[model samples]
Each structure stands twice: as C-alpha cells, then as structure tokens.
Target chain A: MPLYYEKKHQVQFYEVDITSQLTLSSLLNLVIAASGEHLEEIGVSSEELISRHLGWVVTQYHMSIKKMPEKGQTIYIKTAAMAYNRYFCYRSYWLYNEDHEELIEINSVWIMLDLNTRKMVPSDPEIMLKTGAEEIRRPQKFPRIKLPKEQLVADKSYFVEYFNIDENEHVSNAHYFDWMISSLPLSFIKSNHIKSLDIKYEHEILYHDSPKSYVHFNQENNRSYHKLANGNLTAAECVIQW
Target chain B: MPLYYEKKHQVQFYEVDITSQLTLSSLLNLVIAASGEHLEEIGVSSEELISRHLGWVVTQYHMSIKKMPEKGQTIYIKTAAMAYNRYFCYRSYWLYNEDHEELIEINSVWIMLDLNTRKMVPSDPEIMLKTGAEEIRRPQKFPRIKLPKEQLVADKSYFVEYFNIDENEHVSNAHYFDWMISSLPLSFIKSNHIKSLDIKYEHEILYHDSPKSYVHFNQENNRSYHKLANGNLTAAECVIQW
Candidate 1:
C-alpha cells in the first residue's frame, strides 16, 4: 500500500486575502490539517500522543511557492512521512490545483516532545512501524534560517490572544507567519509576492506572552529576515524570499 | 419545499481558541458560508452579483449562543432568507451539535448595494421569486445597538492589513468581531461565556484604514458596548452580553 495520504479542500471565501489569493497563513493551516489527518490514519492520533504524555511539534519548514490558488478553487494536498530518527521525523507536502499542476512544495521536520518533561523524545517504535516510515534521505537539505545581525527595519508587538493559541496551549505556527508578514508595510505586500520561505522555531511563545517581531529586508536579494522575540529571548526566526 | 438550507462542517483545530472551544468569530464565518451556499442554490451567487454590479452587505445581527463546540466535533449549520423589502433582506441561521441540539440562533439584516453607485438598492425580483422569500415578521425585534455614551474601559487600534480585506475590497464583518473580542482581557474571555450579541454596522471600514475600538462594560447588566471608529467617524457599534 502507498504510504502517502491525500485530502481535497475547497478554498473558502474567508481564506483569501485582499489580493483574492489564498493567504500564506491559511495555506499552512491546510498543510497542518492534512498532516494531522495523515497521523490519524496511521494510528498516531493526537489523543494517542496525549495519552502517552507526548506531543508533536514542528521544528522547521522550507517551502517554495509557484503560484497561489485563488478563492473558490479546489486543491489537493498530499503528504507523507519520509523518515524518522530517534527524536525527529521528516515529512513532505505538496499542494496542487484541480488541473494537477503543482502549486507548492513543502518539507518539514517535527520533534516528538514529552508533555511532562517538555523535552524531545524518541519516536514510539509502534508509530514508525505502523506508518511504514522508511529511512529515505531527502535529496535537498533543509534550509538553516539565519537571524539578522543588522539593524531592524520594522518592529511590532503582537499580544497573544485567545484566538491565536491552539490545543497545545501555545501560539500556533500559522500565526507566526501572520505576525511576520503583517509587520511589513501594506504597500510592500501588495507589490510583491512571496516566492519561498524558510522558518525555524527556536522556542515556544506561550499564552499571555506578548511576542514582538523584528524584520530586516535585503532589497538587493529580495529577501527578508525576521526574529520573533518574547521579551529579550528570541522565540523564532524566519527568512522569506520575494 | 423546505426554505432552509443546511451544511455539515467539522470544527478544525485552528478554529478553536485557547480554551479549546470554537471562537465566536469562526462561528460567524460558518454562518456566512452557509448563507452563501444557500444563495447559490437559489441562483444568486457571488459571480451573479458581480455581473450585476450588486453586492450584499450585512447591516445588523442579533445572536444567542447556548454553548460552543469543541474541536473535531461535527456541527450542522442551517440558514434561510426570511424576507426582503425595498432596501433590506432578513435572514435566520441556526447551529446544531452532533446530537441535533441547537447551540446558536442568529438573525441578520443584509442590504443589497449597487456596487457602482455604492448605495442601497432593492432586491432583484428574480432572486425573491427563485428563493420563495416571504414577508414574515420576526417575533423578537432586532435590537438597536446603542453607541457607548459612557467612559471607555478599553481602547485599541488595528491596522487594516492585506489579510483582513475581502473580495469586496473591504474588511469583512467577521474580522470586526475578531478585533472586538481580541481587545478584551484574555482573563475575561476565559472565565465567561458569551450569552448574546447585538451589533449594527453604521459605516464600512475600508482597506488601509486604521480603525480604533472603544469599549464600555456595564457590570450590572453583563453588557459591553463597543464603537469602532476610523479617525473621527464611527464605523460600527456592538453590544455584547455575557
């Protein structure tokens, strides 16, 4: 049997941004939902993980966008677990339009965490076996996002509200993208399109924490570096290519 | 033939707030989506509206909530057009849990606008005939939400970003609710459940406008009145009951 899983979704009206294109944050939401469904199919559901005092946390994501599907379009998302090590699992995701044209490709790394200890833990052996996770090495290396060493071009604070937190009691990853992009001027976002993105989560921003985002743009390279900080500590960093 | 149109949806993880219950803003989104689907079934789709240079704008809403659904739960949303006059259309919506227990009841008024003139217009005769809309008066009169005349308990400004704008090039009504609720103390939202809400849209908040929300809470009546203002002009007013 094939190890990959697929799901079909119609882009809702609310998912589109002002440009009438699906927003980057909503796209990530779809990707995460697809991953959750895939895990459930492999008998590694969230409830099962919680029962074991474990939870899955995404550590890194590298994605390339060819085109953004518009509102009211039907898209297909496919994902699979490529490999698993002691403490981390590698997965791949692809989104395509109704015409079977590829729209985006994403690679993500997830670490299993012990809920009580809040430390990385080895994957359960049963999960690997059940999902038929093979040790296939990825052709392309994951991007290592670098933090900006220069002065900040834009900075803004985002108060963690009830809507931003998720089941894990932390700000959802999608909101990280939201805060990063929202820090830029509306004119910049309206004039440019995101070509690629690489992000790494260094730490978690808990509920009631007001995280601030600092951004630096390299106009020559059409790239932007972002650092999301909770007070003095950096919570996450991201690099975006326009 | 039944006048109501119903749709089934599973509450996604991203829809839930920190408390693991569906956020009130997401609930309104579901209701709007159901209404759109019902409109399409009766030959009045967004595309049709655009072709005729006409659009639907929400003018008022009064909603009563008994409970909120948890993530992963299946809920049914039903909506129907109740009546239409020269300048407004009345609609009703209900949300039900898996057991068929009603969770929410909403009544809304929509004004059809001439997209070119930006003025209120009469409903198309064919639309009324196709939907079999009848002039049935509501049992409970729609509340006239009063603007806060007292001291402001909380005030904050939100910049209209690309993600907040909708297909009509204006901030969607759902985002207004989001900003209003997000402005409240997280502690208050976590401890209290929303019992009812009455809101009126006095003006449209357009893109690139930074609107500020002013709130006044009356502890005795468990009511909070809010006014969303763009500079010196008020855009919308709402009264929330907890």
Candidate 2:
C-alpha cells in the first residue's frame, strides 16, 4: 500500500537562506505543516484536534541539523509512528531529496492535552492505534538546562515590523532568533543553521516605536542570547546551541 | 461537481493592513499563489509556465483600492478568467467581506514567455488551457492609474537583514512594502488591511549591510513612497493608494 502520508514541496525563492540554502526554521515549518496534513488524511486535523479538546503540544525535541537543501530544490517528507507511552507519544520524521535515500531523521515527543482546560492528558489508545505509526518503547532524555532569564544581551539597535508578527498577534518565536542572527553581518549568518535553541517566552511584545533588540553569544559554550526592548512588556529570553 | 480548474482565497493577515484588510500587491500575490496552486494540482505549474524560451512575467499592473478589511475579520476572494489575447493573458480578482459586498476589485495581465530565450510568446491554445485558470469566468475589474516614478514619498527608515532577502538573492518585493509600512509611525500602520498601491521595481537591492529602508506617503492621494536605501543601494520603489 502507498504510504498514508507523503508530500513533495518545491522550495520557493522566498524560503532560502543567505547562502541560498533553505533555513532551519523553513524546514521545520514544512515538516510541521506536512504532519498536520498527514493527520488530516488519517482522520485527524489541528482544527478538530483542538476542538475535541485533544491537542498535541511539543514538550521537548532534541534535533540535530546536519545540512540544509538549496532553494528551488524539491524535497520529500515522510513520517511514521515511533512508539508511545501513556504520557509521551513518540514520532519520527524523515526528509529526503530526489534520490530518496538522502534522508534527515528526527525523533520527537508530544503530550496530549485538554485544550479548553489547558490540562495534560494521556494519549487516546484507540486513536493512536488507528493512525498506525510505529511507537517507541523508551523515551530519550531531554537536554536539561536552567531557567532561562528574560534579559537583553546584544545592545544592537533595530526596527521590528508587521511580517514578524504571526497569528498569535506578537512577534513570532522564530522571528526573534532570525532577528538576533541577522543582526550579525551576512557572512556570519550564511554559514550557520542555529544548531540548537532554548527559549523562554516571558512577556508578549507589542508593536511599538524604534523597537530595540539585544544579542549575546559565547562561541565557547555555543550558547546565544536574544532580548527585546518592549517597556513594561514581559521580556523574552532565548538560548541558542550552535 | 467539485471545481477542478480553479480555487479562490481571501486577502488576509499576510497581505492586509493592520485592520486585517488587503494591500494592492498582496491582493496580487493572493490570486497568483492560489491560482498557481490550482494549476499545479492539475499537472501544470509555474515551473513549467515558460515556453518558446519565454516565461510568464508581470510587466505591470494597476489597481485602485477603495476599502480594506478590519482585524480578525474574514474577506472573500473571487478569481476568474478575464481575457487572453495574443501578448497577454488577462485575469481579474475581487475582495469582499462576509456579507458579499465588494471591497476591492482588480484586473491584470501576464505575458507568455520563452524562459530559455527570455522572450515573449503568443498564448497558444494548449498553453492557455494549461496556465490560464480558465474555469471561472466572472472576475471583477476596477479603475487603475499611472504609477509614479518613485514610491518613496514621506521618508521613514528600516534595516535589511538575512530573512528579508528572498530566493532571488534580493529583498522580496512584498517585504519592501511591508517594512516600508511597518516602519511608519504606529498611528499610520494601525489599520489591518491595505487599500491600494502603485509600485515599480527600480533596482535589485542586494544583501549588503542589509540595507536601510525609507518611506514617504502623502495620505492625501493615498499616495505613498517607499525606498530601500543602504547608503547607495536604492532597492525598490512603491506608491500606495489610500
């Protein structure tokens, strides 16, 4: 039988990085959207998943970036069940190029929740089985860290805009990091994929005047920092592992 | 029967003013992307749109925006065939609210191409059927005017970054306008959707110093001017119709 979910997308020129490769965030968006479409084909959808008071929220994901595809290159995405326990539903994702063996793999875990109440709940066994994704027996340990402080780092001045705002009505989480790294000269950004990132959303940022941004990174520890200036608005702190 | 040859989409957040209404170029992108998607589903795609060494290119389009949408509101987009003559394939579009009353309407034409040759081609019957989006016949039309030489009227500024650069290795067309508008004082960008615009691509603003952006608009003619300046790099020009 054909795979239950498969999508081939052509990278648009708008989705490329400075070096002309697809950015990590763009790849992530494509993967998630493809998964959402996959769920829809298998009788589940983000809209229904939330409406049924059954939501899948990412608790933790440890991803490794090996390489990125170039702009205009077509890529295929395939997903399957890894395994699941009562609390953690494990899933795996594969990214492939034209030849099909060129694959990038990801192992991720999600928690089921009661949307209205915003409470955690175990996976629905019947629902999980119907989807037929491979389930993993052992859950991997998530990278541990201290509580990220919401503070400014790089005192670089900048202006924020409308496109940075997402459906959530604030500057998107991904856009913040994009701003942080883009602040560096283009040559520096062209060679990076933001190896790892840990961010804590402390306060919502509103659209304002001459918005300011700060960045801090320790090449030794491989950690980066981002802090936005929104007076009275809660500050956001992010930790980038690259 | 379910429609096979076409689909319609509304002008929403990504394409609209802060009021959630529509912008002129965004109105163009909305129909272009949607219609392109429809064509691709049927085995024809923009990638294959070029023939005779010529590809379809947007030489120019003019629109007059009378109204736009409000934030969190829904808008309707109806697209259909206008007319396909020798040199250009005409297409038409309209925007409406939930009540079905019209908001903004447009009519534009695209040239047939020979991609390899970078030259024009006549609309052959097979080519027209493949890329013309011929199913819907009742598209709307609105008045258009001559765009000014420069879109930069009132002079506000913005900085270019990695994300601002698109696959073309240049600032994305839409983004130039997005930053120009967003850089405006909050009082100006408060609306959710944009009404109308007259823009022209003056130069390809490259990713150097991530150039600075400038904006000038006279609200009187609904005439606005936007410029992307990185010292000497004047990346683009746009005129807005209030």
Interface RMSD of 1: 1.8
Scoring each candidate complex against the real one, what DockQ results?
A: 0.67, 0.29
- Itemize residue pairs with steric clashes in candidate 1: none
Model 2 segments more than 4 A misplaced: A1-4, A49-60, A80-91, A107-140, A145-152, A155-160, A192-242, B1-60, B63-156, B167-169, B180-196, B203-242
- Model 1 deviation from the true structure expressed as Cα RMSD, one decimal place: 2.4
Residue by residue across B185-209, what tens digits does model 1's lDDT show? 8788878998999988878788779
**C-alpha lDDT of all candidate models, in order:** 0.83, 0.59
Clashes of each: 0, 47
The stretch of ten residues in a row with the least summed lDDT in candidate 2 chain B is: B1-10
Model 1 TM-score (B-chain only): 0.94
